[model samples]
Target: MTFDRQDLSNETLLHLYQHLLRPRLIEEKMLILLRQGKVSKWFSGIGQEAISVGSTLALEADEYILPLHRNLGVFTGREVPLGRLFAQWQGKRTGFTKGRDRSFHFGTNEHHIVGMISHLGPQLAVAGGIALADLLDKKPKVTLTYSGDGGASEGDFHEALNVAAVWQLPVIFMIENNGYGLSTPSNEQFRFKSFVDKGPAYGMEAVQVDGNNVLEVYTTVKRLAEDLRENPRPVLVEALTFRMRGHEEASGTKYVPQSLMEEWAAKDPVENYEKWLLAEGILTETARHSIRETIKAAIEAGLQEADAVPMPTADIQEEIADMYQPFEAPVTDAPAGSAAPDKRFIDAISEGLKQSMERYPDLVLMGQDIADYGGVFKITEGFVAAFGKSRVRNTPLCESAIVGIGLGLSIKKKKSMVEMQFADFVTCGFNQIVNNLAKSHYRWGQNADVVIRMPTGAGSAAGPFHSQSNEAWFTHVPGLKVVYPSNPHDAKGLLCAAFEDPNPVLYFEHKMLYRSMSGPVPAAYYTTPIGQAALAAEGDELSIITYGMGVRWALEVCQDLGVSADVLDLRTLLPWDQEAVRRTVEKNGRVLILHEDTMTGGIGGEIAAWIGENCFEHLDAPVRRVASLDTAIPFAPPLEAAFLPQQRLREQVQALRNY
Candidate 1:
C-alpha cells in the first residue's frame, strides 16, 4: 500500500525527504572512510532511515529522544551540527564528548538527545526517569527511546516497561524489528509473534507500523505523543524493518541469506520514499539532482572540518580534570545549646533527609517500600506525609532500573536520593552505579547529582545478603564519592553534605549503629565537608585511623589499654584525608588502619600503601592494618562476631603501640 501524501504540504514533504536522504548519504560516505582506514568503525542504518527520521521529527523541539547507535537520522534530523557529529565519529577533540567516547555513545543536551550505551536496554529506564521528572513538574513533555529486537529480550527492558506502566509515565518505547540481531535471525530471539504481543503483559497500549513508510511512522508517533501529553502513560511501537548492512563494518553480512536481503532491498525506505515523492509531483528530476548535490556538498564540508580537528593527547593533568564538578559546602553555623537532645544514628539521617527535602524543592526520594511503608528501617516513616507521594516515591525491586531512573532525574536538573535496603544487594545495580553514574561527568560533563544511601556493615546477624561492609567497592571506582560517619552529629552533617554535592555520593550507614549508637545532634541543618577527617581524640604516641563502627572500636580499645593515641575518623574514603594522614604519620611515627571489610581488598591496604610510599622516612615502625576475616558474615552470633574486626582491632592497636 502507498503512503497518502495529499494532506502534507509541499515544503513539509521536501523537508521530510531531505531528512531521510541525509543519513543515507552520510552512511555511504562513512562506509567509504571505514574502508580507507580513516574511520575506526561504522553502524550503517542504510535500509531503516525512516524509523529514526520520522519518529524524531514527530516530537516537539523541547521533548527528549534517546537514540541508538544506528540512528544517524535522529542526529541529522535534530540538526546536531553536522561538523560536530562527524568530528565525534572521527574521535576528534571538538566532538560533543571531547573525544572521551566514540560514535553516538555520547549525548548532547543542547539538542535534547540522550545517547545510547553499548548495553542498549538500560536507556529505556533512563528515559523513564526523564518522564517521571516531567510528570512531577506537570510539564507536557514526552520522551521517546529506541531499541532493537534483540535488546527487548534484556531484563532491563521488562523492568523499564513495568515501572513506566505502573507509574503511568509519558514515554514511548520504539522497538525497530530489523529482522536480524547481528547474525541471528529474529526467529531465534523470542517466541512471541511480535513485540506488540508482549506489551499487553506490561498493561500498556501497543501498535505496529510499516517502518519503510516514513509517513506512517511519523503520523503514528505524532498522534501517540499528542495523546500522551494530555494523559501520561507508556506505549510500545514495533517498527518492522530490515538491517541492510552488518551490525558493524567489521562484521560482514555473510550470515544473512541473499534471498532475504533482496526481498528487503525492494522495500528500501529511502528509495521508495523518493519514488513516491516524484510520482506525486512534489519533486521534479531537477529538484532531486539539486537536493542530492547540496547534501553531497554538505557532507564533504563536514568531513573536511572534522579531519582538520586534532586528536586528544595523553596529558595527565588534562585527563584528570573535569572528572567531577567542583562542590563547595555551604557554611552553616553550629546550633548552640547544651539542651539539644541526643538522637539515634537513624534519626539523624532521617532529620538530614527531611531538612534536605525542605531545602531543595526538587529533591526526590525513591526506594522499595520508602513511601507508605517508610522503608525497611523506618528512616522515611513520615516523609510521604510531609513531602507527599510525588517526592517520596516507592520503587519496584528492580535495582538497575531504579538506579537508571535516578540518573534520568539528575539529567533533568533534579536531585534524587536512592536507598538500598541492604548494602549487599548493590551488586544488582552495579553497572548503572559504576559505569553510568560514575563516568557521566568525566565522559560528557553530565553531573549525576545523586545520593545513594547504603545501609551497610555487620553485627545485625542479617547474614551474607543483608550485612556487608561494601564501601571499599565504590571507593575503588574513580567517579564516585564514598562517605561513612561514626556518630549522630557527623551522620546528619555528612548526609546533608552528600545531598548538596553535585557528583554521585554513596552514603554508607552502619545497620548496627542505627539504634545501638546515639549522640548529640543539633536541630539546625549543617554540612560536614567531604574528604575531611575529624580528630576524634588527640595523643602523640600512635595514630588510629578508621571510620564507621571501627571508630568506636578504636576509641574503646585505646581507653581499655590505657594507651595515649590519636584517633582519626576518615569520613570520606574516596578522597581520604591524605594531608591529615601525613601529619599523623609524621607526628606519631606509627599508624594503624582499621576497617570492617575483608582485609585483602579493603581500603586499609590502600591507606597503608600510600603512607609507606609518601611518609616512609618519618615512620618509626611499619604501618599496620586490622580488618575482618575474608569470609561471609554467618547467621550465628558467635560466628558473626568472630568474622568482624572487634577483637582483632584491639590486638593490632596494642601490637603497634608496643612496636
Candidate 2:
C-alpha cells in the first residue's frame, strides 16, 4: 500500500526510518552473537519492526506501552540505553532486572514501559489498570498493549477488553497478527475473521491496519491514541503483520512454508520503509549507510560494555534481599484506655479498608459486586456511597483480569486492594497473583503494592468452592506476603499493614470467624508488624503455633483442657516470626503446629520442619502437627467437623503435652 505522509515533518519521517532500521540491525548483530554462543537466545522482530516502532512512536512520552518479546522496535523507539538493553539480554548485573529476567521481559519505569510476562494476555488487563490510574488521576495518558493472534484466544483478552470498554479506560489493545504462536498458525487459533470483529461484542471500537506499512501503522495509532486521550475509551487496533523469522533463534522456520515466507519477505517492514524513504526523497543511500553505521557502532559499544559486566553472584543474602522491597511499618502509639467498641472480624476488616481508602487517595477497591452490593461478605458495605464508584469498583467475574489490573495500578504507583470473594476461587487468578504480582518486584524492581483479600476457612458449610484455607499457596511463592489474622484487632491491624506494604500481600480472612469472632478494635488507624507472631496465650508446658481460625481453636482447646501452653498466632505465614517461635519452643519443651488447611501440603509441615531443624535441642517431644485431613473440605457438618482438627486438635495437644 502506498501512503500519504499525513503531513509528517521530514525530521519525523527520518526518525521513523531510523527506528525501523535500528531494530533490524540489532537483530542481525544479535543473531551473529547467538551463532557465536554469546547470547543465549533471541526472538527476532526482523520483518515486523513497523508495528512496534510506529505504535510506540505514536504514544506520548509518559504514556505506558506494554510490549511483547518481538517488539524490539518499541525499546529502540523509546531510546532505552543500548548498553542496559544488551546487558539485560547478556544476563549482566547492569541490566534492568539485574540479570534476573531475560530479553524484553524486564520493564523500566524511566521509559514508561511495563514489561511482558511470558503469559501473554495478562498484560492487557494490566494496561487497563494503568489506563484506569491515568483516568482517575485526570491525566490525558493512554496505554498501548500488544497481543498476538494466538493471545487473542485467551480468556484474559475478552475480560480485559470488556473491562476497558465498560470502564471507558483510555487504552489501545494492539493485536499484532503475526500468523503463528510458536508454530501454531492463526488459522487454528481463532474462528473470527479478524480481532476487529470481536470488538463489537465488548462495545469497543476497533480498526485494522497494514502492520508492515510504517506510515500506516504510525498514522493509525496516532489518531486512535489522540482520540483516546481526549475521549478516554478503549480501542482495538489489529495490525496485520507476519513473523519473518522463527519464534526464536533456536527454532528454525521449517514449520513455516517457503511460499508464505517469500510473500512476507517481500513486504518486510524495514526494507519496504527504507524503499519508501528513498523514493520519497526523504532519505538517500549516503544517509541510509550513515544511520546503519551509527546503529552498528552503538550495538558494538553496548555489547562490549555488557561483556565486561560480571554475571550475578551466588550470594544468598543478596538474592534474598532482592526478593522483596524492604518495608518498615510506621509506628503509631496505642490508644490510651480500653474503651474502644468491640467489632466483628468482618467489621474490623471493613473499617481497615475504609480507613485505607480515606488515607490513600489513590487506593482503589476492586471485586465482584463490591461497589453496589458491598462484596459477597459485605466487607465493602456502603463503600461506594462513602468513597464514590471510582474508588470502590464493581468488577466482572474475571478474577485473572482483576488481579492483573491491580498489578497495573501498583506499577503506576497507585495502591489497589482486590477481594477474591472466596479464597478457593483464587485458582482462577493464580497465574496473575503468583507469576505477575509475586515476581514483579523481584524481577524488575517494580513494587506490586497490591493486597488480595482472601475470605478463607471452612465451618460455614459453604462447601469446597466457597470455603478454603489457602494461605499456604501464596506463602510458598517468594515476593508475596501472606497474612492470616485470627481476631478482630489483628485483622484490622494486619489489613492496614498489608495496605502500607510495598509488596503483594495475600490477606486471608477466616469466613467462619467473620461474624463468630469479635474483639475490642481501636478506632484509630494502626499497623501490626507483618512478620511478628503474637503470643495469644502464654504458658510453659507446650508451644502451639497457629494462625487464622486455628488460633482460636488452639486457644479454646488449651483453655478447655486447662493445658498451660504458649499459643503463638503466626499472623504472617510467609515471614513468620522465627525468633518468637524458637523462644516459645525453648520455653515450652513441647511444640504443636496447627492450621485449618489439609495436613500434607499445609504450612504446618514447613513450621514443623523448621522447628525440627532449628529448635530440635529445645524440644522435649517430637514436633507434632494438627491440621485438617488431607481431603477436600466436606459439606456435611459431621464430615466437616471430622475433616477439620476440632476434636483431633484437642486430642493432639493433650497427647503432645503428655509426651
Candidate 3:
C-alpha cells in the first residue's frame, strides 16, 4: 500500500508510456468500429491500462497470465500484434484463433498468455494450477490472474482463494475494482468496502494501491512477483481504479450521473499519470502528442489490413479438432450373467485408479486427501506406495490450482487424472474447466487431454454444500465429455477409456453407491468405449434408462418388487447413448428415465424428450421420469431420501400395471 516514487531511466519510462498509449488508441478505434457495427463488440479498459501494463512487465517470459476482457494492456505489453488483435475483432482468418474465437477469446501457447474466459472465478484456480506446475517442474515462475470487483463475489473466487492460500500457491490475484459490474457498483454486491480485506481471511497478504499510477502498480507487482520465488504464497493486489467507459460498446454512459463521470474524469489515471510524468520532466506535451498520433496511425493500418483479410476456411478451422481413438471391447473372463457379490462403490474406484495407473504410466492421480487420506471415502488407499508419490501425489488443498495445473501439464503432453474431494467443490475450478480445459482444443486446435474425477450424487446426508449431483452443468458444454459410472466394471473401464480420449472428461462417481455396490471387473488393463451405454438387464415390461446411483437403486427396486424391468446405464452423458435408448425402447413396451440430478434441466429430461420425439411410436406408455426435486441437496436423512430418486422401479411396475 505504500508508494514512494523511484527514479526510472528515460527508456524504461518511455516504454511504459508507449505500452499504455497503444492499447488506448486501439480501444478508441474499436469503439468507432462498434458504432459502425463493423466489430462484434468491444470492451474498453481506458482507465485501467496502468495496472495491466505494470503488472505484466513485472514478470518473466515463462510466467503465466489469465486476463479479463479489459486486459489489452497485458496483451500490448506482451507484444501481441495490433494487426492480430484487429483481425480477431473483424472475424478474419488472420486472427490468432483462425476466426473461430471471438475478439476477446485470444490465446498463445508460446507467449504463455492463456485465453480469457467469459466466466468469473475459474481463472483463480487455473492460475494456481500453473504455479503448481512451476513448483513441480522446479521452475522459477508465478501465475497471475486479473478480475474485476464484481467477479470477486462469485463462489469460484472465494473457493479458489481459500485453496490457493491454504496451499501457499505461487499466485498473484489482481482485483481491478473498476467501481462497477455493468450497472451494479461493487458496494451493492459485497458487504466489504474493499476486496483486499478478504485476502487475510483466506490466509494471504494483500496490498491496496492507486491503480492509476503506473509506477506504483509496477513497483508493487514487481516486489510481489520476486517474493513468490522465495517465500511463496498467494498475494492479493486490490487496484482502486475507475472505468472510463461503460461495460461494453453500445452500453452507454447514460446509466451514470454526468457529475460522477466528470468527477472521476478529472482524476483519470491516464491523465493523472501523464501530469505526474510531465511535472517530473520525464515527459513533455510534444512527446505525449507524438505517442498518441503514432499509435492512432498504427491502429488505423491494422484495422485496414484486418478488414481486407479473408475469413478462416473450414479446413483451417478443424486442423486442431480433438481426435481420440475409442477403446475397443475388451475380452474378459466374466461372461454375461457371471455376476459377483456386491461391494462398496469406493472400492471399485480405488481398483479403477489402480488399474488405470498400472495400465498407463502417464495417468497420474492427484487431489487433496486422495493419497494418505485415501480420499474422503477411501477411494485411493495405498496408491502412493503402489505407484509412488510422484504419480499418486497428494496436493495442497487448492482445488482451482489442482485443476489448472492439470491443464498446464496436459497441454505439455502429460496425462493427468485429478480428483475433486466432492462434486460440489468442482465449482471452485469452474473457470479452468469451462474456459481453459473445455475450450482449449476448439479454441487453439489443441486438446487438453485431462481427466477429472468428481465423487458426486446425494443420499449421504452430507448436506447441500457437500453432496450434490451437478454433472448436467458440464454436460451442456460442447467440448467436454461427461461420464457417470454406476458399477465397478464401468468405473474402472470408463476411467480407463477417459484416459484415452482426447477431450477433457468429467468422471462423476456416486458417493452413496461407493460402499453399497459391487460387480465383476476385468483384472487386466482394459477400457470401455467412451460415449457408449450398457444394457444391464433385459426384460419385456419397460426400459429403465439411468446412470450413477440411479442405476443401482432402479435395479434393487425391480428385484424387491419382482418386476420385469430392463435397465440401461448411460455411462456417458454428453455423447449419450441415444441409439441404444431408442433400440431398447423399441423392444420394451414402455420407457422410464431416472436420475439423481434436479428435475429441471437435468440430463434425464433431455433424454426423455429425445425419446418421446424420436421413439414415441415404439412405446406402449409415455416416457416416465423420476428425478430429485428442484432444490439444493438437504442435510437431514429423511428429507434427502425424499429429494433423490428412490422408487423409480416400483413406479415403473405400477405404470405397467396401469397400462
Candidate 4:
C-alpha cells in the first residue's frame, strides 16, 4: 500500500527515517548498559519510533517543544550530542544536568527545548504559557507539547487544554495513545472511544492518526503547525500507538498479552517504514545499514567516554539555594525613611506589582479572580486596567496547571508572578512548584524566573482551607527562596526582590496583615535584601527571633511587659539570618523563637539547633519556642484564637525575662 505525505520530498522522508534510527540505536545501547549496571534504568519509547522522529521532523528548528519521559528522538533530532546524552544517562558529572537529574531530563537554551518531568501533564499548561508569550510578542512560532494517553486522564491535561483554547495560544497538544498508563490498559483509565474526542470539548481542533505510519503523523503535524504559527490556534493530535516495552526496566509488564505484543511487533514502526523506504526507492539498503552502523558506533564511543569520567562527588552547596545573588538590574534608591507615605500592607503589595510591571515590561500577573475582581483579597486591584488583560490574566482553578504554565513561560525568558488564591490551597500545585520549578535551577543550571504569590497565615476565622502558615514546607526544599515579609515596607521591597532574582520564589503574604497593618511604603522601586533579618526593636536584653505576624505579636508583648528586647524579624526563611541570631543571642544571653505555625516539627527546631551549636556558651537560658498548638486550624473565631499562639507569646516572653 502507498502512503501520502502531502508534499514531503523523498529526501526528507529518507532523512526522517534515519532520525528514527538514532534514538532506537542509542536506547538499544542504553538497555545493554542497564543490564551491565552501567546506567540506572530506562524508559524506552522503542516501539513508537516513527511518531517520535516524524513529528520532530515536521517542526522548524527554532520552534519550541516540551517533551515527555519518552520521545528520545526529540533530543537526537535537535542535535543534542550523543556523548552528553550518554553521560546524562550514566549520571556522570559531565552530563548535561551535571549529574543533578536522572533519565531524559535536561534542556539547552540554544535548542529552545524544555525538558519534561515524570508527572508529564504539567508541561501541557507550561507550553500554553510559552505560546501566550510568543503571541504577546508577535513572534512567528508554534509550541509542540507531548503527552501520553494515561497522562491525558490527569487534571493538568484538561486545565492545559482549556487555557490554551481560551487564550488562543499557538500550541499543538500531541498525545501519544500508547494503549497503557503503566501496567493498566487505557480501557481501565478512560471510557472514551478516543482521547481525541475530548479535545474539541476543550475548543481545540482534534485529530487521530495511525502513529506507526510516519508519513501520516508528519503530514498531519506539518499542516497544523504551518497554520498554528500564523493564526495561533491550539490543535490536539492523538497519535495511535502502543508501548512494546514496560514503563521502565524494572517494571515486569507481565500484564500485557502475548498475542497483543506479537501483533504490535508485526507492525513495528521502524521495520514498517524501512520496507516503505526501500519500496519507494527513497533509500538504498547500504544507506540504511550505514545509518544504523554510524549511530551505533557513535553511541558506543559516547558510552566509553562517559565511563572514563569520574562519578560526581557529593556537594552540600548544590542542596543550598542561590538566594542572595545580586540583582542584574540597576537598583533604585532604597525606599526607607519615616517620611515615606503610610500605606496598608495589601496596598503596598499592589503598588509593588504595578511598579514592577512598569519597570520590567515582561512581568506578567495571573491567578483566579485576579483580573476584573481584583483577586479575592484585592491585592491586584486595577492591574488589568493599567496593564491590560494579556499581562494580567485570570486563570482557571487548576492550581497545579497554573504553576505548570508559569514554569513553561519562564523557560522562554518571561518573568511570571502567579497568585495562589489561598496559601493553604497551594498544595494542589505542589508537585509542579517543588519538582519542576525548584529543581530546574540545580539540574541544568536553568533559572525559572517565576514568583508564586501565596496569601498565607491564619487569622479572621478563614479556617482550615483558607488559612495556613506553611512556610516551613518550602524552607526545607533546596533551590527555592521562601520570603515572608511582615510590615508594608518589607512586603513591597521583598516582592520586588523576588521579581529581580533569577530563581523560583515563594512569596508568602500574611492574610491577617493585609488590612490590619500599616507602615511607610515607598512608591519607587527597591528591594528588601534577601537572606537577612530586620531589627524591629533594638534592646540589649532577650533576643526575640520571629517572622510574619509573629513580629507584630513579639513587639506588642514586649511593649506590654515594658521589657527591653532585641526583636528580629526574619524577612526570609530558607536562608535565615544566622549571623543576626548568633550576635543577638550572645548579646542578650536569652532567646525565643516565635511563629504562627504549629509547635511540632516547625522551623523553630532548625533555629534551636543552630543556636545550640554556634552560641551555646553565650546562652543564659535554653532557647525557647512560642508557636501555635499542635492542632488543625479551627473554624470558630474563639477556637482559632485559642489554638493560635497568643498565650504562648506572653508566657515565653515572661519566662525569658525571668531567666
Error at 168, model 3, angstroms: 1.8
- Evaluate candidate 2 by giving its C-alpha RMSD to the native, one decimal: 1.2
Which prediction has more favorable TM-score, 3 or 4? 4
Residue 344 Cα positional deviation in candidate 2, in Å, after optimal superposition: 1.4
Considering every candidate listed, which one attains the maximal lDDT?
1
Summing lDDT over every window of 10 consecutive residues in candidate 4, give the lowest-scoring window.
318-327
What would you estimate as the lDDT of candidate 2?
0.89
lDDT of 2 by residue, 370-480 (tens): 988888788888998899999999998899989999989998899999999888989999999999998988888998889999988899787878877788888899988
Q: Per-residue alpha-carbon lDDT of model 1 for 9-87, expressed as tens digits?
A: 8998889999999999999999999999988989989999999999999999879999998899999999988889989
Lowest summed lDDT across 10 adjacent residues in model 3 is found at 320-329
TM-score of 4: 0.96
> What does each candidate score in C-alpha RMSD?
1.3, 1.2, 5.0, 2.0
- Model 4 global lDDT (CA atoms, 0 to 1): 0.85
How many residue pairs of model 4 clash at the backbone?
A: 0
